[model samples]
Target: MKHLRELTSLPTTGLYAAIGTFDGVHTGHQQLIQAMVNQAQKTSTECAVITFFPIPAIVIRNIQTPITLTSPEEKAALFEKLGLNYTITLQFTKEMAQLTPTEFIDLLVSNLPIKQIWVGEDFTFGHQRRGNTTVLSQLGMQYGFETIIVKHFLQNSEKISSSQIRNWLTSGDLESANKALGRPYSITGVVKHGDQRGSKIGFPTANLAVWEGKLLPASGVYATFAQVEGKIYTSVTNIGFRPTFVDNEPNAQVECYIHNFDRNIYDLPVQLFLVSRIRAEKRFESISALIQQIKNDAAKSEEILKHAEFQTGLLTGSTKTAP
Candidate 1:
């Protein structure tokens, strides 16, 4: 897929495009993208995906509650996995927000080969979200294009949405969140050097420098995987303020202790995949008590992974792409 940042000029005229923030690229997004791709193939047009960076909320009001499910690079990768021909990353800015419904459509029509457009039923755009499907459809008629409003994809009578996934994550309901996402709820971050407390205790952990404003699940010990050096290691992750040391830290930290592994990954990047929440974080009476709990957590994490039919989302190798 061609990842584009700036709109230059029209390359071709017959393109089928789906436009959205597509944070999680969750099941709902998968359904919509599938529809777009199917329509594009049937109409002999190129498939395109138009998304934004920093999101609209952050760009407009500076309200950053939207815990991004995927970064810009990761979003493009997912779109590529879905076999889209073109992926455009529009920068959401104040100027872009000022466009009226007609003007927005005109801009896309003028710049992109947008023969057909796909949006969700609840999709709103143009100047404080004044444009709705009705306006979009009218513009489609005026501009000689097609407007398709895909209904909200539901799972078990609940709407599958990125917001819902965020709520699930905050609640530590990994199963429900993963169900909505069609994959494990995970976090990717660069390893940051922390107090070498874990290593000193023979349980060296790779501290993750998670993106600011990204929502983390509840404070707990979880069965997870440490994806480092392109290898998946079964590990126990503690997401909490380390109470055993009695520090002044209030923010919850993600610390992954890979079993029987010792390597210096202070500045390396790692992806931590949460398989299940093992137990809530607690303050042990002493260092020995905390160490014993860590050992038990490691053992439990290994057991959970050992019996799995496959590691979380093809840890060894992934051969599948989007449907």
Candidate 2:
């Protein structure tokens, strides 16, 4: 998909546009995007997604939220997967934030033949967040464009939202969160050099230092899957400071020990999909103690993988251990 960084540089074409931070691109966001696609197809217009860079939460909070479910690059990839024609990532600025509702719309819609706008039911925009669905619908009539608002998606009578998904992730409920997201939540990062303590203990792991502003799940040992070079492997990941080893370290870290896999993958990018939490991070008093704990962790991970394999109906012709 074409990424237009500046709204002013957007070409003049009648486009059906969906707007949101689309952080997780959860089920609710998908509904809106699908609606936009259908509307664009019916109207014979280009389908486009208008999202923001440096999401408002990151800019406003000034705290790096853990490992994101998807990075900006991943979000773009998803847009392509969803069959969008163009993706616009607006560089949000303080000046843009100050624009009145009408001014914001005028600036965004200017020089572009926008035939329709799609947003979620609770969508809001403009200065001090004054723009709401009511204002958007009113402006659509005034501007001679159509507006579509998708109702919030409900699961078990509760609204499925990014925040709720975040809550699920924080609570280590990956299955439920994945169900709400319509896909697995993943964290992408490059392998980094660690203390090599795991290797010394016969469980070599690839340390993954997450990107800035990425939202990470709670600190725990989790059954996970890792994707590397387009291949998926079941693994166990530890998401926390190595409390058993480095009790004084302040920052938490993500380290994954891929089961039945051994390859020189240092610096290679990998995506980790959490499947389930096995246990909370804890401090072990001795190296032997930690090693024993890791063995047990690996055993639990193997059991979880076997069950997952059965559930997914993955055929394993042979147990070829990775080297």
Candidate 3:
């Protein structure tokens, strides 16, 4: 996909576009983008996806949310995978956030050939979210472009949303969240050198420090899968400060000890797919105690992943897949 970082960089006028933060690009977001693609194909116009960098919420509210399912790079990659003609990512700023509904539309229509716009039914924009489907519909008529609003997608009668996915993740409900996301929710990070404590304990782990601003699941031990060197493996992951080893560190961490596997993976990028929660993180009284618990956790993780299968409308179908 051609990534246009600025509106002035747009090379053509007739574009069909959809706009959103698209943080997770979950099932609902995919539906919206698919609708945009279908519209573009019907109109024979260039299909573009417009999203903002530094998500409006983070830029405006100064909140450091956790790492998302898809980073900006991953989002663009997914757009390319979906065959979008272009991907436009803008840097959110105070000035841009102040634009009125009409002004925002004018900024795009005046710079490009915008023949159609697609967004979710609950989409909002402009100063203080003053713009909505009503405003876009009115402007579409005035600008001679078509506007389409996709109704909210649902699963189990609940709206499939980014927030809901985040909640499921935070609660370690990976199976439920994956059902809503159409795939396993994963976090990618570089494998770092750890304390080697796991090696001493017979469970050598790959320490993963995720990219900044990535959301992490709740602090606990979980059944997970790790992808390293293009190969996937079953694993157990711990996300939290290692209270058993130390008590003063404030930041939590993610460490995965792959089961039935052993190889050097330091500095390699790995993606961890959480499958199920096994237990809460706790402080063990001794190293031997902790090691024994880890053994149990690892065994349970294997069984959980062996039977783990996501259902609902999101997944393509049901199959017993490890993680």
Candidate 4:
């Protein structure tokens, strides 16, 4: 797929496009994108996902905390995996937010030969989110294009959304979140050097430098698959401040001890897929106690991965792009 940063030079035309933030590209997003892809393929039209970076909510709502589930690069990779011909990352800015519905539609219409626009029933856009599916359809008519509204994808009567999945992750409900996402919830980051406390304890961990605004799962020990250098390793991951060793940490840290591995992977990118929550993070009484718990966590993670079927989505080696 051609992952373009701007619409200035689109590689192809006659586009069947879906426009959204598509934070995690969860199950709901997958279905909608797949539907568009299927129809685009049948009609022999190039398809694209027009998404915004720094997401609209962060800019409009002035959100101060980390809430993104996927980074722009990660989303582009996911879009490519979904068989899209193009993944356009629009650089969202405060000035762009001032555009009216007509202006926004005009911008897209001016850029490419958009044959059809696909969006969810409740999708909104334009200044102050005044534009809805109805407004989009009207604009489509004016611009000589078709608008398709996809129904909400529901699970137990609740619509699967990025916000809902965030709540699930914050609550440590990996099962529900993974079900909604159609894959294990993952965090991708570069490995950086940390305090070497884990090494002293005989559990050397790869400290991850995750994106600033990305939301992390609840503070806990989790069974995870760590993808590094194109290999998947069973791992025990911790996402929380080490209260036992330090106090008042400024941010949550992700540290994972890969099982049966010993290599200097610092500065390399690693993706951790949380399989299940083993236990909540806690302050141990002593260093020995913490070491013991780490051993237990590793054993449990190994057992969990042993019985679980191999998962495929979003892993580095498993990803494929449209031809």
Candidate 5:
């Protein structure tokens, strides 16, 4: 997908666009995006997407601890997979937020030959949030374009939303979050250095620097896998500061011990797909007790990950006991 970093004056021809943050691109979002692509195809125009970064909430409310469902890079990869022709990530600024509904629509119509526009039922924009489907259609007619509003996609009688997904993840309901997302939620980043504490415990780990602003699941041990060079390996990951060692820290850490594998993987890229939460992290009485519990955690991880793999058909790495 052509990533348009320049927000202003986008050179375009025959573009049909969808506009939203599309953070997780849940099932509802997938339907909206696919409809946009289909409309673009019917009109013989390019399928494009536009979103604002730093999130409207963070920019407007100044949320102290802002968490994102998808990192910018992750969102790009997903949109590309969904067969979009281009994605324009505009930096959210105070000035842009001040545009009136008509002004924003005029901006889009002027910049690109927008043949059609797609959005979800709850989608709205412009100053004081005055934009809606009705206003959008009126503007579309004035600009000689079409507007499409997709129905809210639902699962189990409830609307699937990114906020709902975040609640599920925060509550450690990986299955529910995955159900709404139509795929396992994952985090991708480069492996970074950590205190060599895991080495002394005989269960070395790959410390990962998670994507900034990406929301992490609840603080616990998780049954997961690591993807490196297209090969998958069974992994047990911890997603909290070592409560057994550290106390009252502001930052949380993510690190995973790859079972049955030994290699220097620091500084390499890896994607960790969290399959299931194993247990909440706890402080042990002694180092010996902690070591023993880790061994049990490894066994439990393999079992849970194998079951999840069979159910989801993803990351079926070695499930047997690691030598």
Candidate 6:
């Protein structure tokens, strides 16, 4: 898919467009995107997604903590997999947030000949959150475009949403979060050098340097698939401070022990797709106790991975024990 960073760079040809913050690009967001793609294909018109970065909420609410489900790069990859023709990432700024509903629509309408605009029922936009599906249709008429509203994708009688998924992660509800996401929630980072404490303890782990603003699941041990150097490994990951080894850690540390594998992977990029939570992280009474717990976690992770469904194309690498 062709990705453009600015509205000015959009093509002049008429297109089917899906617009939203789409932070997680979760299953709810997928419905609207897929509908646009399907219609665009049937009509032989190009389709594009106009999404905002830093998400409007972080800018408008001045949220300081990391709350994103997927990074911009990851979201673009998902859109491409959904068969989008173009992906437009608009930088969210205070100035852009102040635009009136008409002004915002004008900017989009002028840049691209949008034939139809697809959005979820809960979608809204413009200054002070005044725009809604109703406003969109009114504006669509004036701009000579059709507004298509896709129903919410729901689970357990509740609409699936990014915020709800974040809540699930915070509460250590990996299964529900994964269900709404339509896949396991994942984090990508570069493996970095550490104190080799895991190595000393005989359970060597690759320390990951994750983005400061990336949202992480609750502190615990998890069953995960670690993608490294084009190979997938069944792994057990720990996402918390090593309370037994360190004092006063400023941030959570992510480290994973790739089962049945050993190699020098420092500085290499790794993506951890969390399948399920194994246990909560706690300080063991002794190093030996910690070693015993890790062994148990590894066995449990292997069993969980045996039947877990992996996202397609992500398993292009070896699904068995990575060398």
Best TM-score among the predictions, by candidate number = 6
Worst 10 residues of 2 by lDDT: 310-319
lDDT of 6 by residue, 68-99 (tens): 98878888898998999999999999999999
State the local distance difference test value for candidate 2: 0.79
Pairs of colliding residues, candidate 1: none
Residue-by-residue lDDT tens digits, candidate 4, 118-155: 99989999998989999999999899999999999999
Kindly list the per-residue Cα lDDT of model 5 for residues 222-260, writing each as its tens digit: 888777766677899999878887888578889899998
Output the better candidate (3/6) by lDDT.
6
List the pairs of residues colliding in candidate 4.
none
lDDT comparing candidate 3 with the true structure: 0.82
The whole-model C-alpha lDDT of candidate 5 against the native structure comes to 0.82
Better of 1 and 2 by TM-score: 1
For model 5, the stretches where C-alpha displacement exceeds 4 angstroms are: 8-12, 310-323
Q: After TM-score superposition, what is the CA distance of residue 228 in candidate 2 from its true location, in Å?
A: 1.0
TM-scores of the candidates in the order shown: 0.91, 0.90, 0.89, 0.96, 0.92, 0.96
Where does candidate 6 have its weakest 10-residue lDDT segment?
A: 312-321
Candidate RMSDs in Å, in order, are 3.5, 3.6, 3.0, 3.3, 2.9, 1.8
- Candidate 4 error regions (>4 Å): 9-13, 312-323
TM-score of 5: 0.92
Which lDDT tens digits does candidate 1 get at residues 1-323?
Answer: 78999775646767888989998788899889988888787877888888888788777787856367778877787787777898899998999989898998898888876778999999999999999999999999999888999999999998898888888888878889877877677788899988999989889998999887566888899988777867777788999899888566767898998877777887888888787899988888999988998988889988987764333431234422111
Q: What's the true lDDT of residue 265 in model 6? A: 89
